[model samples]
Target: MRPLADRLAALLGPLAVVAAVSFVSSLGIGVMLPLMPLYAISLGASPVQLGLMTSAFSLMNTGGQLLAGVYMDRYGSLPFIRVGTALYAAGNALIATARDAVSLIAYRGFAGLGAGGNLIGSRVYIAQVAPPERMAMVNGVLASAASAGQVIGPAFGGTVVELFDLRAPFVIVAVTSGLAFFGLLTLPVPKRPAAATQRIGAPTSALNRSVVTLLVANLFLTSGFGGFITTYAPFATELRAWTMLEVGLIFSLIGAGSVVLGTPLGHLADRTGRRRVGVVSTIPVAFFGLAMVLDWPRPVLYVITFIAGGGLTAFTASWFALLNEASPEGRKGRTFGFVSALSNLGTVAGAMGASAVWQLFGLPFGLVLPSLSALLAGLTLLALAPGRP
Candidate 1:
């Protein structure tokens, strides 16, 4: 236990710095989530306008990630982080100042670009610095931080929104992001080797195709999840008579489960083959989406959400492990950037698709989309047997 403590302590400093930054950034991103639709409605935004705002952010977030990856590969992580953090701060400020729905949508897209930069840069930085053996642990820790941020952000944001106004969350996010910018300055910038034969533009076709397939699967699954997340509050308000606090609490439950289980699952991913861990863990994970569709009692909903969060961490840990292992040497930064972007793409598709479905057919059909998405993700993983990799 002493030795384990020492090892964790040694890893904690750098990990903590990155995690802190991730936390603040994620908090900023998530703070507005529960309030977005409400705020838009207050601004006289039509349902279609609200949907467009969410879709715009998803699209920009995905596109920004791809660009961030290429830039990080060419330049370095530190520059991107600095620039991204600044953009995030700026975007939050814009959100605070937004006077109408159109402006809100435009500003959120700017915020999405910043988010893409921060997320991709952080992942690439972790992959570059952490020892290969400890990659899963580090990734898990980061994921946990992200989950913590997601959990806290909504609760905090809800309070801020209630206390002050819808714009209050944006102000808080701007401040938090501002602090993270300074925290990031303390970390050492990793040096990129100039003599390596592989340039940033090389094709990734020959690398582990299985890993790519898994990432695509994740994109599909996440898209569905994103759609549900964006619309869940609205559905609950309309269908279940849930308040903002209740919605925040439900989301927090999901985050808490991930924070608790993420590191252990990551360690397991390292000890066990990533592919095996992913395949085995996805069964229960898919059920979380199904549970939502089932419309279980509130207590049962919490249990299912917890289970789903655990499954999410397990899936993410293994997926990160596989991505790191499969990436070509010297290109992990770019590879991860692309993967990050792809996940955002999934969010865009999910949000837009779900919103459109809900607009047309109502909440039940919208819920079914995510449920089917989880099913497809599980089946896709099963089809890509580790033996093929």
Candidate 2:
């Protein structure tokens, strides 16, 4: 067998290209995430409208993955990625020019189409090129790169927003996505077996049943996590009167923790087993959620968020590895696509649920809901015991 380094170097040219595209695209999305509520409020949007706008973006993102997966599986990865990035660039440009909440929501939904396609395409590309044994490590590297983008995007977004206007971030996102489009052009095209053409059979009910259960569990976990992030800065502002810059710093720290912990944890899973890593990682994630609900001081909250971020990344890397391992060979692309879509559903639910709770009970209670959700998700994983017969 070729050495791991040799295998990696052989794939690195394409992998790095894809990772850069993914990173820039993700950075653009992250840059806009924290600013959404602020922008909505400025546009005189009601709380319901704000929730709808966020949900709309996620719903389209979730729904679009299924279509993207089919297309990629049938045609190839590069074509879809190129088209997706272009759409994303267009959507960002539209968002920059949006004048009303409705326009913003519409534009965001368009962007979600690109986001969904790009994400699935990137994963499929990685799986196609990387050797099976080294898949986890490559995924870890991709996750870390994406996390790094999340770290830089917000701080950069915040700076731009502070200096220019909300539109500035979207314009910057458009430019980055355009760059990603060009980057994807340099990669190799995936080859498909001519006989194995794309076709729609009846849904694989049995496979979907098993996969859907996992997806729902992921949704709950994602929801809890998404809810926490969605509400976190607001919670800090209400509790400690922190400024946007301070909130951005705190968020960046969380991303940094993910970047730091993701690869080592991924390696541990690969060496040991995915189930072991899943179980171990879930514990810290649960506690991190609990800690966030405890009304700790700013410093304490920061530490807790970092720990939570680490645990979250560990769990995600292991969980994805498990999913990849468990999926049927022919259906792997669809399986992952379904999971991606479901996870986005969870994010939307989590964000909406947290927003509602915050309005009803307050920040503390809202935050507590996510902790409870995470705890429940952890329990479900323990019950399922993936990677075992």
Candidate 3:
């Protein structure tokens, strides 16, 4: 136990730095991300245009992840982390100057590149440093850090807007991202080890049975998430007549649940069974959307959203723990990049498609998309993927 304690302590040293970086970075991004729709709307963006903006951002994010993945093993993740965060900060600065929806789309896409770079780099770094035994917990901690920032961001964004203007939050995003960039620059990353197993050359593909199954599940899951997020603020604001502050708080509820429950759920997955926990996780999150069909009171809505957030965190911890374990030695970067690219494509589809759906059919239909996607995700997980305890 003493030896185990010492090992975890050693692991936490690096993880702690990353958590801090993620938290600071996510705080700014979170404040801005959900506001994009409202921003576009304020710029007279139609629903179709709004969908395009989201798709473009996600598509660029996919491209950046693929690009970073190809070189991460050779160069290590530290450079990507610093560079990506820098680009992201620059992109947010650009966002503050957008005069039209078209410009917003272009600027957002550029920012997506930074987001991709930061995400893939962070995951690869975590994979390298965390032991298989602790992957879930480590991931949970990192996610919680990010989520913690998000929990504060939405409400803060609303407050910032009330205090200043809509443009104010993007400036905050740029500033915070800069802080994260400088923070990550200070980490003492070790040199990259030689890619021993990668002598096989960068395969044209990273697909295999386990990987394919897992990626498919992830695609379905993220598709649901993309669909839900794309329509979230508009639905709450337009249909329910909620204020930006209320909407932000609702969004924060999701993040708050993740911050509070992420580590414990990951620990649960580690203890019970990854597959079981992952499948069960879909329940609350999926239902949270469905519950919106009712005209529930505010408190009820908050509770539901919070539980959904916990389920979302649980799914993330369990599924990614499996993914981290499945990555091949010397190829973690490429595999993660590959998975992220494809899964994010699902996000693109969800965002674009759901936008059109809500525009044509009405908002209630939008809620159904995520629930369906969650069902598909659970089915895929149940059918394939490793069920290691």
Candidate 4:
């Protein structure tokens, strides 16, 4: 058994630094998410326009991941991380000064580039440093940090918006992103080993039919969830007559569930089977998403949302563990980037389509989009499980 002191040191080392960077960067994103739709509305954005604006981020983010993936394997992730965090800060600063919905869309798309870089780079870095036996735990730690950031950022950002103005949150996002950039700069960079500098396009057996199947599953899953998020604030506000602060509180519940359950669930994934945990968790993830669309009491809604958040954390831990294990060793950057890009594609499809459905069929009908997507994803997993596991 490892000493307690050794465990503590491992927890607080470079791995922790990467997790901290993810937390700070994700905090900026969380700060803006619950408030952005309202801000667009203030700029006279209609439902379709709001959907477009929300999707602009995902579209641009996909492009960024594709580009970063090609290069990061050739170079390394540190430069991308620094640049990505800076882009987030700069984009938010621009967003603070936006005069109309068009500008908001443009700036947010630019910020998406930064978000993509940060996510792909961070994942690649973790792949390099994490001990294989504890990959799920490391992912859980990183996810928990991100979730904690989401919790604090939205709750605080909502209060800031309510007390001050819609623009206040953007300024706060910029500040937090800037802090993340500087924090990333503090990490040491040693010369890359020969094996670490392999060509980005090198062929590997890991990127086979099974991985492709999983990516397809990822696309469906993220799309449903992404669509749900796009419609979330507006639905909650319109159906429940919720205030901005109330909406933020509900949004924070997702993060709270993740923070509370992430580690334990990851440990569960490691012990049982990642695929089994992911498959079992999908039902609750879908159910809770559908539940939030209903007109439950506010407190009841909070409990449901929290459980949904836990479901998401468990599902993510399991799926990511599978992906990490399957990825080719030297080509982790490209693999992670590829998966992120596919996931963002689903986000774009879901967000844009959900709003359109909401506009045409009503909010409750639109809420069904993600739940349907989750069910499809679950079905895909079930079919593959017998073959793979």
Candidate 5:
């Protein structure tokens, strides 16, 4: 057999293509995400409308993944990826023309469909291509690349908004995503590789119990994360009196932390149990959430947010690896899709829940909501002992 180096070398071309696609697509999304609240606010969106806008995106993303997962299992990822990129580009472009809160919310939801397709397809492609021993590390690298995009995109979007206009970021996102869609055309079509024989239907028993446990764990954790992220920009603006540039920098720090830590954590997860790492990471995540509730100086806010970002990033990398390891062989696509759908469902619930609470009480309670939920997930996962089976 060829040496492992040679084998990996052969896979490099395809890996590069996938990574590029992931980076560019995520770049487009990152550009929009931090600025989304500002854009909606410009359109006169209330906190409730803001919550609904984010919820709409998550809802559509969840639905899209459910559909894409099935089609990917039946057919392949390349076509879905291409179509998804096109739609993503279109959605971003259309959002630039949105003149009202309702139109912006609708456009964002439409964009989520494309985003979901791209996310699921890229991950499934990675699962299919990487060897089991290296899967987590590869996934981590992909996550890191996505993080890198987040780092750059937000800063760029912030600068654009500060320099030019609120609408400029949407236009830039559209142009870049269009370029990324063209980039997709140059890549060779990917085929789903064969794996261990899989039973067709789900009886709950069809999958490893650990897999189910991990899924449940993700549901709660993702909800908390979603709530935190959705509230992040808005709270910074209204409560802390931050500029758009400052908000972008805070988000950039989060992405920067993730990019710095993702690969090493992935490597560690591959060696130790992913569940163990994920469980440990959530502790700091919850603590930071609580910490953020405290009124701090702007610089202190950056430091705390940075550390919280690292914890959350570590948790997600390990969690994703665990999901990959726990999935049955032949159904990687659908299995991941299920997780994606569930995770987004949690996101919608968390964001809406937090927004409601924020509307009622204040920023502190809104901030506490997600962190407390994460604590609950961590405790539950510990009780479940996810590594046992």
Candidate 6:
């Protein structure tokens, strides 16, 4: 018999081309993420302006994902994926030349559209190909690949900035995106599931209680996350007295944890129950947020942050697995789209709101809000999500 590693390799071999493309693209995005807040500040943005930049990205990201969801079923995922990737690359290139915050924000908005399209396209493709019982496991493999890029990207971003300049990283990102685009060209067009054909006459999925509740929960969940990412870099640098290198390393740590833990956790969720795992996964993230506010020691913060990544991966694996399974045949795109829309909207709100709180109240309250959002998200999930026991 083939060894487990061999078996798993064979399973993923067919997906390697697409997965490689995703990794390259993700790496490019990862390289820019850690530096983004600082870059905005360099462009003379105020804290609120930084929030606006992030919100701009999230706004278009939400719209693009929602639009892609509406059309992916009819037009297919490949087109959106291809175009989105190209646009994202272009956005990075534009950012490299950005002379001011206004231009940067506008460019980010453009990039957000690409983010949305690529996100939904890849998700639908994954759902169609995943074996029913192995949804989380399959997603785990993908997450691991993406996180590997993220692990490398931030670390690389820091080194490149020190070695050259901030513009250099953005330039590198543009080049990598082109590589991903070429890789994507090798893909065969995706076909909808045979099951979807069989259900051709079935009605579109309605926004029932379970679906609506799930969306709301996701919205709350993403909002906290959105707020944190936008605010964190600045806080780390100005208040925490952490160097940019330290911040970069921290992001790398998160990514590294995701790469290390994503697959194992997914398998665990599959066996233990996706919903149960998802519910449990929320605890670490909520704690991580609150811990940050309370000024946990740096070493402890690192440990919690790493654990938070694992929790997030577990939650994501389970959540997507559940979403895909519960979706009506022929409407998976729309279902995922709706969830993305809500989630990204939450991101926009979180980023904006967090910025507002930090500007007005202080950093402690800035941290407090996200913690509350995350806690509420889990509570909503526990009470109302499908498979509640």
Off by over 4 Å in 1: 1-10, 41-48, 191-208, 230-248, 292-301, 348-369, 382-389
**Reference-based lDDT, residue 117, model 2:** 83
For each candidate in the order shown, give its overall lDDT on alpha carbons: 0.76, 0.75, 0.81, 0.77, 0.75, 0.78
TM-score, per-candidate, Cα-based: 0.83, 0.84, 0.84, 0.81, 0.81, 0.82
RMSD vs true structure, all candidates: 4.2, 4.2, 4.0, 4.4, 4.1, 4.1
Which pairs clash in model 3? none
Better of 1 and 2 by lDDT: 1
Q: Show pairs that collide, candidate 6.
A: none
Across 182-207, the per-residue lDDT of candidate 4 in tens digits comes to 88887766234365665474336657
lDDT of 2 by residue, 107-177 (tens): 98999888888888788777767766666667777787888888888778889999999789989889888
lDDT of 5 by residue, 173-264 (tens): 87877887787787666555444344353223315676677777777887897788767767778877879887667677778777887778
Candidate order by decreasing lDDT? 3, 6, 4, 1, 5, 2
- lDDT (Cα, 0-100) at 313 in candidate 3: 80
Q: What residue pairs clash in candidate 4, if any at all?
A: none
lDDT of 6 by residue, 1-389 (tens): 35655645544643575566567667876786779998988989989889789778878988989999898888887788888888888998999999999999999999889878888887777777555566787777677788888788877888999999988998988888777877778766755667636544343464655567667778888998878877777777777788878877777677777877888998988787777877777777788767766778888988877877877777777778777766777787888887878776787789889999998998777877887787677667665544521
Cα lDDT tens digits, model 1, 155-188, are 7888987799998888889888888888888877
CA deviation > 4 Å runs, candidate 5: 1-3, 34-55, 97-106, 161-166, 186-191, 195-208, 229-249, 293-304, 352-366, 379-389
Candidate 3 lDDT over 1-389, as tens digits, reads 78767868777777887887788667876686668899899998999999889777778888989989999978888888888889889999998999999999999899889888888999888777676576777888888998998778777888999999889999988887888788787676854545564435233345656668789989999899889878877777888888878876776788889999989988888877777888888887777777776777767878888987887888877778777666666677888888988887787688877888888998888877877888688668786544564
The residue-level lDDT of candidate 2 at 91 comes to: 95
| Distance from true location, Cα of 169 in model 2, Å | 2.5
lDDT of 6: 0.78
Alpha-carbon shift of residue 332 in model 6 (angstroms):
1.3
How far residue 103's Cα lies from its native spot in candidate 3, in Å, is 5.7
Please state the error at residue 136 of candidate 6 in Å. Answer: 1.2
Output the TM-score of candidate 4: 0.81
